[model samples]
Target: MGSELEMGKRPPENAGNTTQVQNTPPNTHILGSVSTQTVDLFNPPSNACCFCWCCCCSCSCLTVRSAKDKRILMTVSEKQEDVDTNKMPQLTLEEVHAWGESFERLIKSAQGRVHFRQFLKTEFSEENLMFWLNCEDLKKETNKTMVEQTVKQIYEDYVSVLSPKEVSLDSRVREVINRNMLEPSSCTFDEAQQQIYTLMQRDSYPRYMNSSMYADLIQSFEQLNES
Candidate 1:
């Protein structure tokens, strides 16, 4: 078959005999013959559309793995990129709860709920799906490291701006934080609300309210209260 799509110099006759180069689509230059057996430009395999595939392959290097694993890696990597760029998905109350349950199973940490919740601020879309996957990776790669890192970052970045004043709180807020610290995953809505109300006294409630530890505390309290 004639190489109608050929746009560059021909591949050397021996290109495939020794070198198995998987070139990309745009500006692809084959150093050997374009045979039927010659592999198509290594477009990453994806469930996503052509735009996503092209975007992924163009931006990222395919991993070194079995062809199947390579495809999986490329798909996952590109999916993550797309999710990061796209809006997050939306869910009804039931769907959100289901999603949370899935997260609880997969993430297995208080911080995971925090990460997933943070992601929910954006619209529910392919992008958020990818982000959820990435957060899972982050959870896996760093374990509790992310929490300490966040704590350190907050300490470094925000601490400098504020006077060395301790974060004053009403006893209720202190009690909530203390309870969560002891239980690690137990804080309920009423208890948490009391904490928040107490924090309002010091204007420190909102600052720590969105924290995963706080969320975990609330969640733990809820779970325990439910139990």
Candidate 2:
């Protein structure tokens, strides 16, 4: 009752003539001092609060998960391409080896033709050769486009027929062979030869595709100069 009266009779210190009385509790003075000196130790910056922590953690997890998913997708795409090649007709080992050999021979002959054509272009007279020059240019342009199209076809076909699980080294080699052979711009004579040698050495062609049929096709094409 006495404390209540004291509180009710409290007055402002600056009220000089007013009926003023001190009503502040003695313990309140200690509380005020403690509160002022003891800083808010756990208080964080606005950007480092609980909501921010949650957001940061969530974002980090999502980023990691997304990266994993991307890697999985890329792996799946490659595997699908391998699968596509498996759907292609299987060839015996002997046939694949023979085909590889035939392909080598064809590549050699093609290189020879390229050399010959270049020689002619260099040595032939330029006078009255406008038509010939145009023809040569057109031929080169057509060949370049054809090779690009062929590589694309082989890549597509390989990706279409095989199961992702079954696509293996042999399939990869076949795809590489097709790609290398068709890439006229990048497949130099020496590079093509090296590719042929590598594939033949692997000895995977015989059992992977119809190696014999492929060999015969190559031989026929080479003999007829029908490339």
Candidate 3:
């Protein structure tokens, strides 16, 4: 009974004052050292945090869980072109070995094409392979209308000097392409294709043979075969 009476008693500081206490909201309570009202956990104010019921005015309790891992994120360089290199088809040991036999063999295989394309990318001449690939696709099209459209698109993408993906071509080849543009056909890019093919075979293919990407792939497959 004495403890209950002590709890109900007011502080002695306001004993002789004429102040009258007005009734406030029933559940609101002053919290923290600075007398800020505690926020409702269910519907906290915008300035307050939902994870904690304490007012942001004076509360200093920890609010969030500590981070568990610090991962080193790999950044893509600005020079990296957006090329799709996924979904590589399964390759046989013989097929992979054949890529080393000749540049002609590598460009003909689907598996070899992607790997070689990537290798050319490192040399900053992937555009040459892309132009070659586009021309090959253009050759397959029998529709005259589509042949015209694709030839024009390929010219804009690779043959034109204005194109960012333009491949290096001699003036003679460029002049032939300019004349061919008047009556666009599947064979419009044949000369340019031959030039790029020779360029890749002579320059890019040899380096690609000794490239780490090719070496690692062959080593991995060889290791797999042994086991």
**Per-residue lDDT tens digits of candidate 2, residues 138-173?**
234445544333223222222222321111124444
lDDT of 1 by residue, 45-124 (tens): 22222122211334333332245444434433343342221122321223323433433332343333333333322212
Model 3 whole-model lDDT (C-alpha atoms) = 0.57
For candidate 2, the TM-score is 0.18
User: How many clashing residue pairs appear in each of the predictions shown?
Assistant: 19, 9, 0
Q: Is candidate 1 or candidate 3 better by lDDT?
A: 3
Off by over 4 Å in 1: 1-85, 90-142, 154-194, 197-227
lDDT at 116, model 2: 21
- Lowest lDDT 10-mer window, candidate 1? 152-161
TM-score of each: 0.18, 0.18, 0.61
Off by over 4 Å in 2: 1-64, 79-203, 206-210
Residues 85-120, candidate 3, lDDT per residue (tens digit)? Answer: 234344666777899999999999876786676565
Model 1 scores a C-alpha lDDT of 0.30
Q: After the best TM-score superposition of candidate 2, give how far the Cα of residue 29 lies from its true spot, in angstroms.
A: 98
